[model samples]
Target: MACGALLASACAGMPDSGDVEAVKASNAGDSQVRVYAVAPRDNADPEEIVDGFLEAMTSDDPGFATARKYLTKRAAQSWKPEQSITVLTNAPHRGQADRPGDPDNEGRTFPLTGRRIAQVDVRHAYRPEVPSAFDTGIHVVQQPVGDGKTKEWRIDSLPPGLVLGEADFLRNYRAVNKYYFASDENWVVADPVYIRQRQDPVTRMDPVTQTVKALLEGPTKWLGPAVDSRFPSGTELARDVRSLAPDDQSKLRIPLNGKADRVSGVVCKGMAAQLLFTLGDLTSVRVEQVEILGSGGTSLCLLTKGQAEQEYSPVREPGRGENPYFVDDRQRLMTLEAGGRQPDKPAGVPGPFGKGTVQLGPVAVNRTEDRAAAVLDNGHELRVGSLTSDEELPEAVVTSVAPRLEDRLSAPSWDGRGDLWVADRNPVKPRLWLVPGGQGERVEVGTPWLRDGTRIESLRVSADGVRIALLVTRDDRTTLQIGRVGRGVVDGHEEITVKDLQDAAPRLESVTAVSWAGPSRLVVVGTEAGGVQQVRYVQTDGSTSATSVLPGLNGVTSVAAPYADQSAPVVADSGNDGVVRLVPGANWQPVAKGGRVPVYPG
Candidate 1:
């Protein structure tokens, strides 16, 4: 049960003389170093006795010898042959007897497991008996354990008495044999316990000790005041109510069948506020509504199931199947399924679905006459109906066309843009696809080099549709490549490499997004150890500078420079805490409290 007993038993096979010599040599430079002895209990198992000896050294009972039995042979043989170990005196006590007639219990008695534990507190003293072997200041304490019956106890487990030394006592002794066995008798005492504890000066904070007081205490002390402080008046409650609709006179409707109180309004963008309503473990709620702030402002627009019916059609034709589509009634963006239609089948040939010319269904948004578009998943595009919807979508007008090579037909951008860039990771050709604008055709950009297994971690396009920035990572190193829209060669295009910018700011990990900060300057948002970095580039003069805009953020995943003045910088962080923080200016202020932000109104 002794702490060192296990380690001692574990290293028991090590040669005793070599271990002793090594310990002596390691202590040669320390004048105060001394060895203690332990006595073995009568009738104790040899293995258990050795375990107890090691345990006393380490202030634990199971001992080093017993613990060493479980170690691999390589670990046991790695001990130095010429190390010296200290022994401690024995303080024995009897063990409690087991209950009578216990089937599993043997009549074997042992030492008191708790009382046998001891500590040989090593004290480093300055004086040395031999000036040549020991230094004036360096001192060490060594605690050696042994059987309870003899004062000459075999060293088990590393003696705790050795100060500023390795846990591997034998190894230390072998490395510094010249300093071994030089003890100071003046420092030796029958009992060497109860030493005063010292506190770390740099980190410790003592209210009474003004001279030793830390400057700012711990790290939490620096941040705790702000995190725990109260918010500005009405700022907390201002975000409580749902934001009013853009139009003052619009009506609001509830989409689901539940209590409105269950919904929690998280954020408001322009006139619409995003709400999260909780129903039960099986269901959660999300709704965007327009709130009325005060007089003259419009009533909130809460879309109801009844109103949604007026906006959507649920009929399925034999030739044209019905496609489920998502619609935001507030935004008037109607998503209708398209392309899942079938033509009459021929006499001998089966259709796509074992019938005839099949339609995969299409999604259309009602805007005006002759302007409706349909999207398909297989990279195909089509025109659904006239932009002006005089009636329900006409199936006969659907026309299929090749998608833009750079278009992603199936997965559209959340911003209602028909064309979204998606990297084709088909292994054969890694390329970028621009999902056709308004769903007509897709355009493929970039070279086949992407198919050669280069991973594109992030991609960003300039607002003017001229420049494209991509963060490509290979073999744990990330490289930023910026190219013009029509360019196939990344290096050949007008680009900025991240490696070149390391001289100015060394902590930039990866560039997430790039935007034009001004006519002659470009803003680069990067992920750094301290958080998001906002770098300003003067392209005309080739001058660049970076500032730590956001601190304590894990990484910046996305960045948006919405305003021309670069006053509003929107950044998304995908860290342990998934929060999309908006830093407006020099002092970064969080626009949204939590992760998901409201996308209505603005």
Candidate 2:
């Protein structure tokens, strides 16, 4: 069968391509882009054939037809790449085994093995399960022709999927979050999307340019309808964009086509926000300002990341409408003033959770610090009430959920819009719940990333409501994963779901907690392979920095970072050393003794 015939056979009875709406965006321009792969040569050994095949897989070729050249005609036709793609964490190992082949006995059988990063299914969903499950074998055959003196080793048998080393994979694959507005315009969600670029991400200007290109191409097919963009339809960068760019000052100049020529200033800034948030995420580029240009390279407006945050008003700001609050050992909910580091006395504490019989389970304050949600009876029931200073207490309990002690609710997190989000750790009924601010409507949001048997230990929605941090425990290992939130109309109603889930802290074996330290940084408390507990600062893309995670935070039970920027890290000592905080270039300062689980408003 022909190559097209083989692929056609796979999708034989599926919906029409136009109606299916599953077209994938291509990364190639008119010029071919090669990603460091040499063509195969005659008389190649089985190992060389295998190495060449793996290298060809890294090419940005559509359907990897170039990679199949190393395989025998029969094997290439039989290969079904749509089955699955195993992303390797390291380079694959190649070895030969005794088998019948050439006179030298070196062109017959081979095996490949590696530690995988993830497995992406046919529908493009990423699965981060047992990464060491792949160990494949390949058989090679020599194509007899002309004189038998020249032997050519071609793969006769191999398994599905592509394998690449960590370095190459990092160079080829880049993650960018496409910005979309929540049902409430006040909030914008970042939908994480991975795109391939012909040029390396380390190259100057390429990272930002390619990222902005991907953003303009629009969200992936699966997530398109769930989000919206400010960039007009068919918007693209002008052919000659560099002439307008200010490379010295790390400025990005994007000249869109005519589709977005006359967009309002608000729309242009929102477009800039999307680009700034997306490009600023690149490990290689530091985007200070984005200049939105129109046709003919005419400048429309200029915006900075800080200005974007203000104009969009997406992220929740700490100390804006929030006051300090904590639960004491006596089950009292204490409040602290703006400058005071310690809470008030138990007698001076406020709220019903302090006076009621509910034992004061894990508590979370709203974005405004005027409402509190607490779990009761070891996580069976949850209730919400007003936190106003002079308001009348609820006559009785306000709202409650299914009561079961075996499964509990993780700490609740509130978004900037005053909506509360909580996860039920119930294995039988595991779910994430969202309670709208005023109406108090509880809705169950679907999170496919929350695989079965995986328990969500902690969940925190970013102040901007675009990203979420989760501590998931599975198979006795805890890891931190972040996903972009996508909200849109579904079944004629507003629905929010988490998409593009990726592990943010893959090196950590046991993660106890996670908190957003900055717009793109996460402060995590976890342990490495040796089981030595420590705190780490990591980016949303899993990259680490020296100053991201503060030092001297060991034996820290709970950790908290301000929503805006790095301040003194407030920590709860694990060994009763008292609640201490670390200041850069200084010593640890004690905040309050015996405090755990420090948190900001949202």
* Most lDDT-accurate candidate: 2
Q: Which tens-of-lDDT digit does each residue in 106-208 have in candidate 1?
A: 3232223211111211221111111111111111111223443443212223222322222322222211000000011111001001111111111131111
TM-score for each of the candidates: 0.27, 0.68
Task: Give candidate 1 misplaced runs (Cα > 4 Å).
Answer: 1-420, 487-507, 512-543, 546-552, 563-565, 574-586, 593-602
The count of residue-pair clashes in candidate 2 stands at 0
lDDT of 2 at 529: 81
Note the Cα lDDT for every prediction shown. Answer: 0.28, 0.63
lDDT of 2: 0.63
Q: Look at candidate 1 and tell me the lDDT of residue 308.
A: 26
> 1-602 in candidate 2: lDDT tens per residue?
11131211111112222222111112222122234334566566667677667766665545566667788778888887545566666666677665665676645667777776665444333444444655887778786545756657788878775565554444455545666555446445555554454442222235456567667877644445445788888898876442233478888788888888989988888788888777766666677899988987798889987777666656544225334455555566665443345423213345576565557666677776667777664666567767665345443222334365546677788877777888888776678888788236677777886776887888888876766888887887888887767777889987888777778877677788877765656778888788777777776656443344556555766666665544434444444764455544666666556554556567
Going through the candidates in order, what is the number of backbone clashes in each? Answer: 114, 0
**Candidate 2 vs. true structure, TM-score:** 0.68
| Model 2 Cα shift for residue 397 (angstroms) | 6.6
User: Which residue pairs collide, candidate 2?
Assistant: none
